[model samples]
Target: MTITGRCYCGELTYCIESEPIMKGNCHCRECQYFSGGHPNAFLVMSDSTFQYTKGKPKTFTRSDLEKPRTREFCGNCGTHICTKSEFRPGAIVLKAGTLDDMSLFDKPDMAIFTIDKQPFHHLDADVPSYERMKP
Candidate 1:
């Protein structure tokens, strides 16, 4: 199933060739800070199968304890688009809200990094929640 997405400004567009491997909301402090919200729901796609349909997105390599991760966003609007890691080769996590048809993806399987989750946000106890990245 091919999926289409665009940046907030619609200046940058992308297409993914396959169904996402996973979909989930991340509550890590980094993600919360970057998104300016509770958590970010993202679709995991293969880097090789993801293509830019319009304008090149500006990329920034995040510096942290983990391996370097590259963040791609619209240069004009600064809409956070995708995050890719060489360490996790072939996988790119695309921000789900950016997709033109977000309903096409399955509901998130779980929430991660709940240790830093916002106090006001309440998640279902039934869903698997991880204190940090699952092993």
Candidate 2:
């Protein structure tokens, strides 16, 4: 089944031709900074199944180091969209909140970067959390 999403302003949209590899929440310092001080929930899918169906987005690279990941966002409204990480080849990280019909997706199976999770954010005991990225 196809999955679709759009940026907050609806300027940037995308389509995923297949199911995601995984869904998770990231509380990494980088994610908190980019997501306005909170964890970012997203779907991890293959690049082969991803497509841009609407306006172009501006990209921001995280880390100048060897494995820099790129984030794509709506240029018009500055809405966060997706990410591409060299660390995880063949995968495209898509922001969950941007989904056109969020009900179709399941709850995140993992919570990454728990070491940096804010004190106020209480994670469920059963949500499988990791101090760093999911293994």
Worst 10 residues of 1 by lDDT: 61-70
Deviation of model 2 at 106, angstroms = 2.7
Q: List model 1 lDDT by residue over 1-135, tens digit each.
A: 888989888999999788788888899888987788779888888888889999998999866647888899999999999998875688999998898987865578788999988987677777788998766
RMSD of 2: 1.3
- Top of the candidates by TM-score: 2
Instruction: RMSD for all candidates, in order, please.
Output: 1.5, 1.3
Instruction: Candidate 2: give the clashing pairs.
Output: none
- Candidate 1 residue pairs that clash: none
Error of 2 at 61 (Å): 1.2
Q: 1-135, model 2: which lDDT tens digit per residue?
A: 799989888888998887888898898998888789989888888889688899888999855578788889999988888888878898888888899989755788989999998997778788999999767
Candidates in order, TM-scores: namely 0.92, 0.93
